[model samples]
Target: MSLEVKNLSLKIGAKKLLSDINFKLETNEVVAILGPNGAGKSTLFKVLSGEHRHYEGRVILEGKDLKSWKASDVAKLLGVLPQSSALAFPFSVSEVINLGRLPHSTGRVLDHQIITEAMSKADVSHLAGALYPSLSGGEKQRVQLARVLTQIWQKSDLGERYLLLDEPTSALDLPHQHQTLSLARDLAKEGAGVLAILHDLNLAAQYADRIILLSEGLCVAQGDVKTVLTPQQIESLYGIKVTVMSHPEHHYPLVIAS
Candidate 1:
């Protein structure tokens, strides 16, 4: 199964945030959305996650329009980690993560087990009892990731599910950045579709199966890493000179500013 966007477009007053955006996210693949600032990446995520629905085209999941799904059904099929989160009550990290399990009716033992596994995968297990609002920015980001991970932890019995992440590594350090993306790769390998908004091209090259590069609210290129992330495309998109070479380790294209 796949999530298909057909000629999708969004506008806010006089500004067009997205224009004729179309792509298919298949199961078990990580698709990274790359672009400079103001490229409409966040707006696209808002459209997909049901926050902004006044778009021009169709977003279909499992052959049905996404807007037609019930709220609980949408929850079952999609997990979203926004760029930032806020907590008002000073909830502990564990409590915040447990909120992801609310849609399911599992027993306490099973819920605890899933929460534990999610925390471990996010590398936030050590912060279990810590109050979420007191944690550092990077720690909070990891905890939020754990929460979303818990939301779509299990595969649906009907069809494939999806995870939408918006700049999930923005506040993370280098090691945690790799760790978070690695967890996303693992989720994709388990038959979940992943769409991540990322600024770091090298990380996208290493982990994403496909790349969608947007500029001025348009998709300029979309394909495998090597095909879409050419030096010419990179330079044109960012208006900067760059050297593109094979990575010394994995042989994927390594983009370095020159």
Candidate 2:
């Protein structure tokens, strides 16, 4: 029903990178991880994605230990889009996106259909024939998103799908930034749990169902947008004074820095 991290802590060499962190990402909601630099957001993400697996504590995926799940089986349920992708291959955009279908035995016809749909959803359909390395940063970001989207395009027998997006909108334009998160929201509505690492408080407020704030490898706060984005929390974490106000046309909090 959810991805749960219990008492999660990670240490590299003698220095601790994460400490006793706990959070759950439930189905059908978008969650944003907000924090100052070096707060272990990316480290938490890497742990969840199985990149740094030597940490203490447990990551429970759907009532089972995450480490016990086979890599291929896990791929069917979780799609991860990191802060950046480094691929210098000459493959075309569509080819890069098609690589997402590798984990599935879905037939060629069905895989092509899914790839096309993902490209459309990620707004990279027009770049289907373009060389992957030739695209701009934002364009490459969308293309990488399309690739991950195709990976978990359908909810397998695994029950619920999950998206672990590390700064998904980092390279996007303002409109495309909204567009990207909107697409994540749509996916969540379809029963996927979305967890993204975001730096923009307003963007997280506008789209996330909840926000988890971390500072210095620990969670500072975690709750609904309005409750967690208070002026006090902003100042304490980022060392900046800000006023939190309700958006004039929307229901979420808007943090205005002074």
| Maximum-lDDT candidate | 2
lDDT of 1 by residue, 79-172 (tens): 9999998786889999999999988888899999999999999999999999998999999999999999988999876567899999999999
| lDDT of residue 25 for candidate 1 | 95
What is the lDDT of every predicted structure here? 0.93, 0.95
Tens digits of per-residue lDDT for model 2 on 171-255?
9999899989999999999999999999999999999999999988999899999889999999999999998888888878989
Report the poorest 10 consecutive residues by lDDT, candidate 1. Answer: 152-161
TM accuracy, model 2: 0.99
What's model 2's lDDT at 191? 95
Q: Where's the lowest-lDDT run of ten residues in candidate 2? A: 245-254
For model 2 the local lDDT of residue 103 reads: 93
Candidate 1 RMSD computed on C-alpha atoms after optimal superposition onto the true structure: 0.8
Tell me how candidate 2 scores on lDDT.
Answer: 0.95
What candidate 2 gets wrong by more than 4 Å, as runs, is: none
